[model samples]
Target chain A: MRAFVLFMCLSVGCLAQRPQPCASPPLLTGSLSVSTQSEKLMAYANYYYDALRRRIRLTEFGSYNNKTFHLDVLLLYREGVMYKMNYKNQTCCKKPLSADFHPLEIPWNASLLGQVVIGSSSGPGQGVLVNTWEGELQMKEGPAKYMSTVTEFGCIPVSTLFHTIRSGWMVTSFFNNVIGLVDPQQLIPPHFCQGAQLEERLDEDPVTFFSLF
Target chain B: MRAFVLFMCLSVGCLAQRPQPCASPPLLTGSLSVSTQSEKLMAYANYYYDALRRRIRLTEFGSYNNKTFHLDVLLLYREGVMYKMNYKNQTCCKKPLSADFHPLEIPWNASLLGQVVIGSSSGPGQGVLVNTWEGELQMKEGPAKYMSTVTEFGCIPVSTLFHTIRSGWMVTSFFNNVIGLVDPQQLIPPHFCQGAQLEERLDEDPVTFFSLF
Candidate 1:
C-alpha cells in the first residue's frame, strides 16, 4: 500500500512519460461567461492535446453552450507532450511538432467529426478555441462571405533571444473580426540568430524580415 | 472662412464612404496588450497601424535587437467595423463589416494605406478600403495578394460550414495555433436567431453554434 501511494503521488507531480507544465509561477484561473467584451479574462485553459486519453462522458467539450464546464486542466509544455486524458477518444497521436499556432492545418482524424485548427496565433498567450459537436449546427453563407479581412493581432516581438520558443497569442478573429501578425521569434530567438542585433533594428523600425532573420 | 468651414463639414461626413453602420452595436474599447509569464506579467502593445497613417509615433517599432517575441498587441476593433485613423494624415479608413461575422474582400487600392475606416458591422453592409499612396498595392503573387491578405484569412472560417462566428474582436493566429479548424457554419447560426432559446442553448451546452434563421 505504501509503494502504491508513493507511485500515485509521483505520477501526479510529473508524468514520467510526457512533457507537461507543472505548478510554475503566475497561474491564471477563471471561467468565461460573456460572449462579448471580456471572455478571455478566464484563465486556466483546458485541452486534450493527446486526443486519445482525454475522454469525458459528457458531450460538452470546452464549449459555452450554457453548460457549466468542470474539468481538470493540463497545459502541455513546449515539448508537445499530452497525456491520454485530453481527448474523448483514446487513440494516441504524436508529432515531432505540435499544432500549437494558428493559420495552421490539423491533419484529419476520425474522432473529430468536424475539426478546425487555429494555431501559432499572433495574439497574447490566450490563444485558445471554443468548439461544439456537429449534431447541433447550421451552415449558412451570407453577404459577409464575399468580403476579406486583415489585422495585426499579437505580432511577435524581437526581445527574448535566449529564452523559450512560444509565441504569445494576440487578438483572435471571429468570423467577423480579424487580427494582425505577430512573430514568436521575438520572445525566443531561433537557433540560427543568437548573437546578432535583431531587437535593436526591429525596435528602430518594426518590420519582420523572414529572409534575414 | 465661414463658407469654407461649411463645405468641409459636408465633405467630412460624406467622404466617399460606404453606408454607415446601422447593425453594428456599441463595442467596448480596450487596450491591446500581451501577457508574459515570468516573475511578473508583461504587457506591451504598439500603435504602428497609427504610425502607418502617421497618427502617433512610438519610440521604436520593435526591440532594437535580433531576438523574436512571442506576443504583443496590435490595433483592432470589434464593434463590427474597424477604424483606421491617421489623425495627422487627416485620413480615415472605414469598413462596415463584422469582425467576427463579416468577411468581405473590400477591394484595396494601395493608396488606402494610413487611412481609417469606420462603420456598423453587426451583420453586413457595404465596406471600403483606402490606401495612402497610389491607392493600389503591388500584386506579389496572385490577384489575391495585390487585392488583400484578408482572402486567405477568410478561407479559415469560410472553409468550414456551420461554425461559430464571434461578434467582437478575436485573437488571431499567424503561422500555427490549435483553434484554426472551427467550422464557422457549424458553430454559428443565422443572424436572425435570437432570444430565450438562443440564450438557453448558449447556457446549457458547453458548446456554441451559429443560427441560420
Candidate 2:
C-alpha cells in the first residue's frame, strides 16, 4: 500500500510538471496590429478559421505607407490555392499555397514560460491570466523563432513576436477579439475572385507576405 | 420658363455646396491607436454615449510606458462628476467635471477640407467616402486646432488630429468599429467605484489626460 501511494504521488507530480498545449477556438474575429522596424501596419480584420476544412480567411482594412488598402486573403489547403483579392482595386491574384494549415495553438515542442496576470490578480474577474510560450518553427529555408502569449482560460491569442531570417523581427498584437465567427460567409471567396489572374510565384510565408503592405 | 429653370438650378447647386455636419453613432466598440512625439498608446475600448442623459463612458485596456493599464472613465455631465477607475488596482477617483457634454459630431464652425475616398474609387462597394473637417476648438486655455476625418455614409470616425498648447500634437485612429452598444451596463460604474476617494484636482482635458499613460 505504501509503494502504491508513492507511485501515485509521483505520477501526479509528473502530470503537473508536463507542458500542455493550448488550442485557440476554431473561429475568431479580431483586429491585428503588426509592427516592424521598417513599417507600422494598423489593420482591422476579421479572421475565419476552419481547421476541419483546412481553410482560413482574413479580410483586412489597413493603412500603411500613407495609403489605405482593403484585401481579402483566402488560404484553401484542400484546393492548394491562395486567392488574394484587392477589394479597393477590384483585382484578384491566385498562387499555389502548398503549406499545411497550422492551427492557432502553442507548438507541441514549445517551452512554457512562466504564467503571468495581465491586469490585477487581487480579485476574480479583474485580470487575464496568460501563458507565454516560445519555440523555433520548422521551416523549409531555416528555423524561425517565435514567442506567443495566450489567455489561460480560452487560449485566445494576445500577442506574438516572430523573428525570421528573411523577415527580421516583427510583433503582432490582437485586440477586440470575439470567440465565434461574426459571419461564416467571410470564409468563402467573393464572386470577383473567380476571374483571378494566375501568378507564377509561389505564395510566401503569411507573416512575410502581410508585411509587404 | 427659362428664368424659373435657372432659379431651380441655382437653388439645387447651392444646396449641394452647403457643408453638413456628420454625427457618429451614439455607441461604438473599437480599438484606438494614439501616437504622439512622447509616447504611443494602443488601446481597445468600448464607448457609450448618451446624448439625452449627458453621459459618456470609456472602458479602455491600453499598453504604454512599458506597462499595461485598464481604465474606466465615466463622465456624468448632468451630475457634474467624473469617475476614473483603475481596474488593475481596483482603485477609483472622483472629481468635479463641469464641462458640458459634446456629442460626437463634426464641429459647426469647422471648414470643409474635401471629400476623399479611402480605398479604390473605381467601383461600388470598393472604397470608403470620407469628409475631412478642420477647426479651432473653443478652450479656456487658448484656441486648439483640430482636424477630423469621418465616413460620409454613417458618419463614423476614422481619425482625429489635435494640437493643443499643453498636449502638443497627437493623432488618433479608430478601427474595428461596431455601430451599436454591445453591453449597456458598461456605462454604469463598477461596484468598486462606489468607494472611490474624492480627488481634489480638476479633470484635465481628455486628450491631454490620456497621453499621460
Candidate 3:
C-alpha cells in the first residue's frame, strides 16, 4: 500500500517534530497538593529547583483543621533579576525575571485525574515531553465532569502552568528531580536574617507578583 | 458522497463544539503589556468591575524613559476571598480567590504578535463570547514567533488577565470599562494613608502571594 502510506507519513512527521514543552527548563524537586479537599490533607508543598539558574526554593508545611502551617521562599533568578527571599519572615523582594517567573511557568502537574490533551507528546522521561489530551472539566457549580491530567516536566507544561478547573484541587509533583542540586545556602537570607528589608521593588512587572501562589 | 462526508463531519463538530475560552468568570477591565517591549508607552493599565460583586479595580500608569509610574489595586472577590488593596503605598493583602484570582484567570490577551487562537468568537459586545485561535508563540530566546490575541468580556480573557510575553515593553490597557462603577471608596484604606498594614494572608495556598502580580 505504497509502502504503508509512506510509513504513516514518515511516522507522523517524526512525531510532529517533537520539542515544544517550553523549549528547555526543568530541574526540579517535588511535593504538591495546595489542598482543595476531597482526599484531604489540606496543605504541603515542597520545591527546589535550578532550571538554568532561574533558581527556586519553597517549603510549605500543612495542617488545616488543627491549625499548623508554615511557608519559606527563595526565588532568586540572578542576571535577569527576580529576588524575593522571605525565609520565615526575613523579607526581601524584587522583580524582573518575567514570564511570570517561568521556573517552567508554574502548575507543576496539578495532580492526575484525566483529560486536558494539549498536544500530547506522551509518556517519557527528561525534556521535551508534552501531554494534555484526555480532558473533562465541566464544573459550573460543581459535579458534572471534572477529570484532568496535565503533564510535561522538562520543557514545561502543566497545562501551561495550572487550572484545568484546578485539577480537582491539585496534588501533582509526587516527586521529581532533573539531576538535583540546590543548597547554596538555599539561595540567601539566613545569616541571622536580622534586618532584611526591601519588601517590594517589582520592575519587570509579572502581574505584581500576582499573589505568588 | 456520503452527504459530503456528513457535511464535513458536522462542520468539524461545530468548530469543536465551541465554548472553551475558559468556561465562566470574565467581566474584566483592561490594561496589560507589563513591558516586554515594542511600541512606545512602556506601561499603562486600567480596570474596574463589579462582576456580581467579585469586585475589582486597577490603575496602572507608566513612562519608562522618563520614569513615572503608578499602581493602584483593589480586587475583592468575596465568598472565596481575594482582597489585595495597595492603593499606592497603602498595602492590604489576603488570598483565596483560587483559580489564580479569576479575572478570567489572568492572561488578558497578552499582546499581538503570533499564535494564540481561542475560537474566533469575533468582536461584537458583552457576555459569554470567547476567542483565541489566531496563535503563534514559539520563541525560546528572542524573536522567532509571537503573535497572540486571546479574547472575552463578561467572563474575562485578556489571555486570562495579561502577559503575552510582555509585548515589547508593555503598555496595554489603552482604556477599558465593563460599565465603570469602581468607586466603593476604591475598596477602603485611605483615612490618611498613614500605616495601612496587612500585606499578606493568602490562605488557599495559591503559592502564598508569590507577588500578587
Candidate 4:
C-alpha cells in the first residue's frame, strides 16, 4: 500500500500545542498524576480530557499470554435490563447492565443521504438507541461508516485504591486522585509492551517495513 | 435496555458533576470560514467557548459532515518528520520524505495481561507520506483498545495567502496538520457508511428473537 501511504505521511514537521494551564486536564495519561491534575482540571468550566473520554465500540475477545485484553466498557443499570461492565478488577459483586440499543435504526430526517442509507423499515437493524445527555444512553453503531459508540462512565473502584494499578495513570479521588485512563480512547496508541512485537523485515532493500502483516 | 440504563443512571446523576463552560469542545468541521483575523485561542485562557470552536468527537466522521470532509486523529509531531509548510489547504508538491518510525503494535500492555499485540517485522513499507496533523487523519482499525490517540481539525487552504488566508484554531497551531491517508482499515463506522452492516442477532426464544444477521 505504498508503505501504508508512507506510514501515513510521517509526522508533518513538528506540531505543538496543549499546555496553556488555565487549569484543566482530568486525564490523558502522561502521568505524574496527570501533570498534577492538569492544574485542578480547569476549575469546572467544562474540562473533560482524561484522555478524552467517550467510547465503547466493543467486540473485543480474550487473550492473556498471547496478549490483548483491555476491558473496561461497563455501562451499568442493573435490575431492569442492559448490562456490560466487563470488569477490570473482578470484585465488589458486579451489577450494571441495560445496553442493547435495539440496533440503531435511529434516523430523524438524517441528511447526508439518510446517514448513508437505511430505508428498509428499521428492522434489519444496524444499531441506534440514543438518550445521552449523560442520562447514560448511547449505543450508536455504523452510519458515518462502520461507526461504533457505547457510553457509561461512573464506576471506579480501582481495587479499592492501588494495590498496584498503573497504566499511564489513574487514581481518581482518594484525595482528588485522577491519573490516566479517563478514556480518550484510553489515550490512543499509547499503552503497549506486555508482549509487544511487530517489527521484522530482514531487509532486501529495506530501510524499514514494519507494518505489512 | 433497562429503560436505557435508567436514563443513564439518572443522567450521570445530573450532569456528571454539572460544569460545562467548555469542558471538551474543540472538534470543528466544514463550510468553515472564520479567519477574519481573530486569533486569541486560549491565550492564557479565562473562559472560552465559541461553542468551543464547534466541538467535535462523537467519534467524529468530521462530526458527520458539515465541514466538507474533516478528520483528525491525534496529530502531533516532534521532528519525527512531517512538513508541507505544516499542512493547510494541502499542497506538498513533493519534497520531504524520510522520517521513519514504524512501531504501530501496542495490543495490551496497560497491564492486567491483555496479551498485547502490535508487531510488524515488516509493516508499512517506509516513506512517501502526508498527514502532518492540524486535523483530518482518523484511522485506527478494530483494536487500539488502549486507543492511543486520534485527532483532526478543519478549515484548510492557505497555500501562502496570495488568495489571502490563514485562520486560527489549530488548537494553538504548530503544524498539527497531517492528512495522512494510511487507511487504517476504516470502512466507516462513524458514518463513513459504505459496506456498513451490523444488526446482529442469534436467538430462538428470548423475546422471540433469531433475527440479526
What TM-score does each of the candidates earn? 0.18, 0.47, 0.24, 0.16
Residue B15 accuracy (lDDT) in model 4? 72
If you superpose only chain B onto the true chain B, what TM-score does each candidate give? 0.18, 0.77, 0.30, 0.17
Better of 3 and 4 by lDDT: 3
Q: List the residue pairs that clash in candidate 2.
A: none
TM-score for chain A as predicted in candidate 3: 0.32
Backbone clashes for every candidate come to 146, 0, 72, 106
Q: Which candidate leads the pack in lDDT?
A: 2
- The reply for model 1, stretches above 4 Å from the true place, is A1-107, A110-213, B1-19, B23-213
Task: State how far residue B212 of model 1 sits from its true place (Å).
Answer: 16
Candidate 2 residues A1-213, lDDT tens each?
Answer: 999999999999997665477777776655565655334555656667676676778777777775787777888878888888887687778887767667778877889875654322332322345677988876667988888877766777767878777766566766556666667777787888887776777535554232221
Ranking by lDDT: 2, 3, 1, 4
DockQ scores of all models, one per candidate: 0.07, 0.03, 0.02, 0.02
Candidate 2 chain B worst ten-residue window by lDDT: B118-127
Q: Candidate 2, residues B1-213: lDDT per residue as tens digits?
A: 999999999999997776477676666544455655334555656566666566777777777775897777888878877888887787888887766677778877789886654322322322345677998876667888888877766776667877777756666755556566557677777888897776776546464232221
CAPRI accuracy category, model 2: incorrect
Candidate 3 chain B, which ten residues in sequence have the lowest lDDT sum? B119-128
